[model samples]
Target: MNNLLQINSTDVTVFVFAGIIVLALLFGFIMYFLFSYRHKQKDFQLLHDQKQQIDVQKIELEKTLRELKSTQAQLIQQEKMANLGELTAGVAHEIQNPLNFVNNFSEVSNELIEELKTERQKTESERSAGTENDIINDIEQNLQKINYHGKRAESIVKGMLQHSRANAGVKEPTDINKLADEYLRLSFHGLRAKDKSFNADFKTDFDESIGKINVIPQDIGRVLLNLFNNAFYTVNEKRKSASDSYLPTVLVQTKKLNSAIEIIVRDNGDGIPKKIIEKIFQPFFTTKPTGQGTGLGLSLSYDIIKAHSGEIKVESKEGEGTTFIIQLPIL
Candidate 1:
């Protein structure tokens, strides 16, 4: 009977040990589940917060984009105004010549009229026949001068109107040689009017063989004016720091081809640097100081030429000079 009791005690001890191990495993599982739940909750909250932050940031980005667009519009308008101002300056310079001739000839004609009136009052013997004829001839010439200049001024005004008025983008037969010459003088005189100290010598070599081609005269004129302005600006800038012997000069030449024409503009100023030469045609790329340039001249010229199925390129050597070549197809 004692041995049977000892066996029962040993079985109870084994049962108790097994029960304790099962309880420990249940506690371990509970702890693991609790910790995992907490971590998952924290991760979910973090993601929710990040999503809210991203939404707020997106709103701010949209606002910023709108503001940027508004600023861009303003700048574009400013650029347009600047272009109009330059063109006006050019027009004024061009018109002044004819106006001056008109005034001077008017004054001379008035003097001749006064002389003829005085001669008429003199005695028949005192009034020489030759004197009347000479005065009449001189007055006729003066009248012709006035008529010519008045017509020139009228033509210039008409041209200004044509440019200002809105029209369909139609190509017309344009004499590029004459167009180039006109703009060169216009650009030079406009610059001179703006800056009294500005002075430069210019040379032109126009190929008379290249007759009128179908083009938008106003557009091509604009391109030529821009190039001429840039050339003059470069030469003028160089003149400031250049030696006394340095002479600022701009050269414009035209060459005719069977299927194309080349307009070459060269300036004896500090040439463009090699590193930035390739980017010259890029919009908003400029080497000029702030407020000095809009950086749209070359970029616009490039686009205009490309629109007309033409090409424009630049060549430069630092501290020497720069040249721009424009090739336009004979379409």
Candidate 2:
């Protein structure tokens, strides 16, 4: 009985020891599992925060880009208005001459009518048939003069309206020669009206065979006006310091190529300096005195030409003269 009791005690102790070891291993595994789960959760939360930050930055960048585009549009419009302002005075002056002619001819024709009625009222013995015929001829001539002047005024008004209106961005067949000539005269008159002493002799040599070309008239006209105005400006400036023998002249020439049409605006004045010539087409670049220029004319012209699938380049010498050549595709 004593031996049996001793064996039973030994078996109970061994079983207790085995149970303790199993419990300790299970507790250590549970702790490791909790720590690994918490570490994974922290990494996932950091990634989510970074994703949210990137989204916010993207939204802010888009908003900034939109604002920048709006600002650029406003500046471009302002430049167009500034150019139109220069053309206005010239349009007014150009219109006035035709108006005066129309008014004078109308008045003369009225007088002729009164004289005709008077002649008709006269007795056959008092009125000579030859005198009646002469009066009628004079009246016919006056009417013709009135008609011609009326048409002239109409054309000038059309041009003013065309220049003032916003570009519709539509391409149409346009008489390039006429367009160039018109702007050249308009620019010349504009300068003259501003400064009574400003004078420049301008000439045109156009290739009549080029015919009408497909282009955005308003945009091309704006380009020509800018160049003509600049040419006149340079010549006028040179005139101020030039000797008595100096003659300020501007010449516009056009030609036809196999696949393109070329327009040349040449001036005899203080040519652009070679150092700054390459920068002329860049935005906000100008040699004009402050407040006298916006520095956007050439930049805009460059853009316009490029939009039309054309090229514009300049050749200049410091003291001799400058020439701008533009070549537009046949399309």
List per-candidate RMSD values in Å: 9.0, 4.6
Provide the overall lDDT of each model, using Cα atoms, as 2-decimal numbers. 0.86, 0.90
**Backbone collisions counted per model:** 0, 0
lDDT, candidate 2, 1-331, per-residue tens: 7656445877888999988998988988988888998898898889888888988988998999899778777777878888878987787788888899989988988998899999999998999888889989998998898889889889888866776675456899999999998888888888899889998899899999999999988899999999999999999999999998999999999999999999999999999988899899999999999988889999999999999999999999988999999999997
RMSD of 2: 4.6
The per-residue C-alpha lDDT of model 1 at residue 82 equals 64
Estimated TM-score for each candidate: 0.73, 0.83
Using lDDT as the measure, which candidate wins? 2
- CA RMSD (A), model 1: 9.0
Q: Model 2, which residues run further than 4 Å from truth?
A: 1-54, 128-134
TM-score, model 2 to reference: 0.83
